[model samples]
Target: MTSMMAPNAAGLSDADIANLAAHIASFGGAAAAPAAEAPAAEAAAAPAAAAGDVAAGKAKFAACAACHGMNGEGQGMFPKVAGQSADVLADKLKKYRAGETVGPMSAMMAPNASGLSDADIADLSAYMASL
Candidate 1:
């Protein structure tokens, strides 16, 4: 079998790092990257948020209130989502939908995120960030 280095071990080109930074910035988050292969980590977390309707996002968020609370404050064991950048929220939801484990809540979140379309993600992210 061919040996594969870890993404960090392999490192990233300058162009790749710049692209990752741009992607993060588009999501309204600060562009931060290590001097090494930081692009791998950033790329994994980066997802673009499409334009969304805040009103609709609010309506959609009601379904999430059971765990996240009406204001996205999050209840016990459900981490706070309010004020998170749109890109972060969208990327996390996307990962959950794809059944990729992100944290302790991965199993619980998978089902909730499974049915979300890109538009849904965008709307939800917008709503959560506005909180």
Candidate 2:
């Protein structure tokens, strides 16, 4: 089988993914278990939150508040940023900075993200995660 598929190509949720990982482990194919991705991805991101200062992020978030709302509840056409995973936030910001379009907000987000440094992105990610 291929190593990966769409998140729910098989109609599996996060819990389902874990169960599949367990089954893979039981089959003596631990090395091929897709569930191991959880830990590896987590390990890779472990330093991201530490690299940022929450206070600074809150200050940085002002630009985003116009659309996302102060509490990240989002408004009108904007999506909520609060409560998002730091990893997700960092990735999206990076993509936006690189001129990659994520969705309807891409045009708006790119300009906002363009001037952010890595540290700025980290701080925003950390603060968003804590929301």
Candidate 3:
């Protein structure tokens, strides 16, 4: 597992982490954590929310393709978003919007998030999760 506390260069957050844990759980595995802390466990056990529009998400994802790649496989410094949960992706974006995360890598993503509406975020999240 990658560092979850590295200033979230990808702008991930507690909710995002939880969503990721839930996403992975759907496949019968859990996201790794340093310890089975309450927050981490709770995140891992949380149910996924029904949000995002796959079609709209596909459109929004076009903007992310540059970094996340066409198939969400990622390239260069970018990480994989394919198969990641929409909740996770949304939460990460929320962190970026909230200024809870940042870095040179994240800086690039920061501006991309601009002009995104909540529905856009949900759709993009759904699309990424579908990938």
* lDDT, model 1, position 52: 63
Q: Give one clash count per candidate, in the order shown.
A: 0, 0, 3
**Model 1 lDDT, full chain set:** 0.69
Candidate 2: tens digits of C-alpha lDDT, residues 58-108: 977766765577787776667888898887888788778777899877886
Error of 3 at 103 (Å): 6.0
lDDT of 1 at 17: 54
Give me the overall lDDT of model 2: 0.69
Tens-place lDDT digits, model 1, residues 1-131? 11321332235567755754454344443322212223666655645465866777887776576567768887666789999998888878878877889999898787667767678788889889889
TM-score of each: 0.64, 0.63, 0.59
Task: List per-prediction Cα lDDT, in the order shown.
Answer: 0.69, 0.69, 0.62
List residue ranges in candidate 2 displaced over 4 A. 1-47
Write down the lDDT that model 3 would get: 0.62
